[model samples]
Target: MSERRSISSGSVFEERIGYARAVVDGDRVHVSGTTGYDYATMSIADDVVAQCAQAIRNVEAALAEAGCTLADVVRVRYLLPDRADFEPCWPTLRAAFGEVRPAATMLVCGLAEPAMRFEIEVDARRR
Candidate 1:
């Protein structure tokens, strides 16, 4: 049987957020909802596009930690604070996943942090 492993960069959430950044089980890796915040600095980027890019980067970093890459991603979830923001950032997302063409869903809703404009999460598998 395969074992489950938690993916963390030694960061901790002060609140009672019952979640890990990512989890690896066998050949599969699942990343939790990731925001635009720079985990190193814990600050959200100012630009929406930049934030979107950073969010994806963070996802990729998590995947890499699990011995995976963006190409291994099979699904993604994008959460935007507004539809307008989603429209403008659609192209960026498409370009990022152009080759992978992972199944994706975009949503608009309030995020945990006000400064966060976009959040992304992904699921990846490796053989």
Candidate 2:
């Protein structure tokens, strides 16, 4: 049997909300929906595209901590408060997953905060 590990990005919400950024069990990693907030500054961009970029970076960091990368992602989920925002993020999202082309889904829905225009979640298998 393999061990389980939890990775944290030091986001206050992780503690306040009672969740880790990602959890690793054996060869798989499950990363929670990450927002655009730069954990270092605790600030998020107003532009949806910019937010999408940062959100990808955030997810990458969590993946890295688990010895994985975007290339190892097996699944990805993009959540947006406005469906219109999804198209604008495609380029950035494609830049990260174009070759890897993980299974993906984008949903139109509300987020934790009104300022949060985009959120992303990923599942990865160690490769």
Candidate 3:
């Protein structure tokens, strides 16, 4: 059997928070919960729709590094701070995953950061 490998993007959380940004085990990639905070500025956007887009962008970045793409995604988990934010952002989410049609779940919950409105995590398999 091939050895499993862990991958990270030098996110400080990998050290301080006891979790990797992404883990690659053979042909599978498991991405951790990612928020809309721009890594460059370390700031979360104020708008929920924009935040949803940014979160998906972050997921794509991790998937790319794992040799996968949105089309390769098999599952998605969305954590929303408020249920009210879901409808407004559904269109964006639907458009992004329309082709992939990955299994998904969205839940209402508080996030790790106060300013963050949404957190997205994904699982992808290489073709």
Candidate 4:
């Protein structure tokens, strides 16, 4: 049987909210919806594009901890509060995922905080 383990990004939310940043079970990794906040400083950008880039980096960190990378991602979810903000983030998003080309979904909804403009979550299988 494959062991299951949780990964953390050293974010207070993971501890305060009681959830891991990602979980690795068997050959699969499930990463939680991660926001744009820089875990080191808990800082977020005002521009959605910048936020999108940071969010992707945060997701990358979690995936790396699980012995995976964006190339291993089979699914991805993008969450945004404003639909318009998503377009401006396309360039940054494309730069990160253009090659990986994982199945993706984008949803317009309220996030945990008003300052959070973008969040991302992913599922990956080790190759």
Candidate 5:
């Protein structure tokens, strides 16, 4: 059987919601949907572009803990409350994912909190 482990980023939501930031099962890493909120400060930027950047950083942190990098990511999902906000985030998204070119999807939907303008989730394989 493959070994299974979970990683946390010390976010209040993790404890309240009872979920890990990411779960590592053998070489495969499944990162939870991460928002712009900085776990350390519990703060989120109002701007979607800034939120996108921060969300990317949060996802990267989880990937790192799972012994993987952005290059290892094979799939990604972007969630936004507004469809129009997606295009403005293109440059930032491309900067992080342009090289890796992982299979991706974007959904326009309501988030847990109204303040959350963007969220990101990823799946990666440890090399």
Candidate 6:
């Protein structure tokens, strides 16, 4: 059997909701749906583009803790309440995943917090 390890970003939500920011099991790393809030400040930006960029940074942090980077990501999922926000965020997302071109999906759905304009989740394989 393979070993499993959990990583945390020290988000209060993780403690209340009982979840890790990411988990590493064998060669695979699964990052939880991460919102745009700067975990250190527990504050989020109002602009969707800014939120998108912050969300990627948050995901990258988790990926790094899992011994991988965005380039190792094989899948990505984006969640937003408003579909129109997706296009506005494309450039930021492209900048991160453009080279990797990981299998991707975007969903229009409500998030836990109304302030959360964007959320990102990813899966990566450790090289």
TM-scores for candidates 1 onward, in order:
0.91, 0.98, 0.92, 0.97, 0.98, 0.98
* lDDT (C-alpha, whole model) for all candidates: 0.85, 0.95, 0.86, 0.93, 0.95, 0.95
Backbone N/Cα/C clashes per model: 0, 0, 0, 0, 0, 0
Q: Candidate 2 residues 19-87, lDDT tens each?
A: 999999999999999999999999998999999999999999999999999999999999999998899
User: Would you give me the overall lDDT of model 6?
Assistant: 0.95
Question: Which residue pairs clash in candidate 6?
Answer: none
Instruction: Decide which is better by TM-score, 1 or 5.
Output: 5
Q: Model 1, 22-60: lDDT tens per residue?
A: 899998899998887777887777889989988888888
Error of 1 at 115 (Å): 0.7
Residue ranges of candidate 2 with Cα displaced over 4 Å: none
Question: What is the Cα-based lDDT of residue 51 in candidate 3?
Answer: 95
- List pairs with backbone clashes in candidate 5: none
Error of 2 at 36 (Å): 0.3
Give the C-alpha miss distance for residue 124 in model 1, angstroms. 0.6
For residues 48-107, what per-residue lDDT tens digits would candidate 3 score against the true structure?
999999888888888888888899999999998899998899898988898889999998
Question: Which candidate order results from sorting by lDDT in descending order?
Answer: 2, 6, 5, 4, 3, 1
lDDT of 5: 0.95
Q: Local error of candidate 4 at 30, Å?
A: 0.5
| Candidate 5 per-residue C-alpha lDDT over 1-127 given as tens digits, one digit per residue, 9 for 90 to 100 | 9989999999999999999999999999999999999888999999999999999999999998888889999999999999999999999999999999999999999999999999999999998
TM-score of 3: 0.92
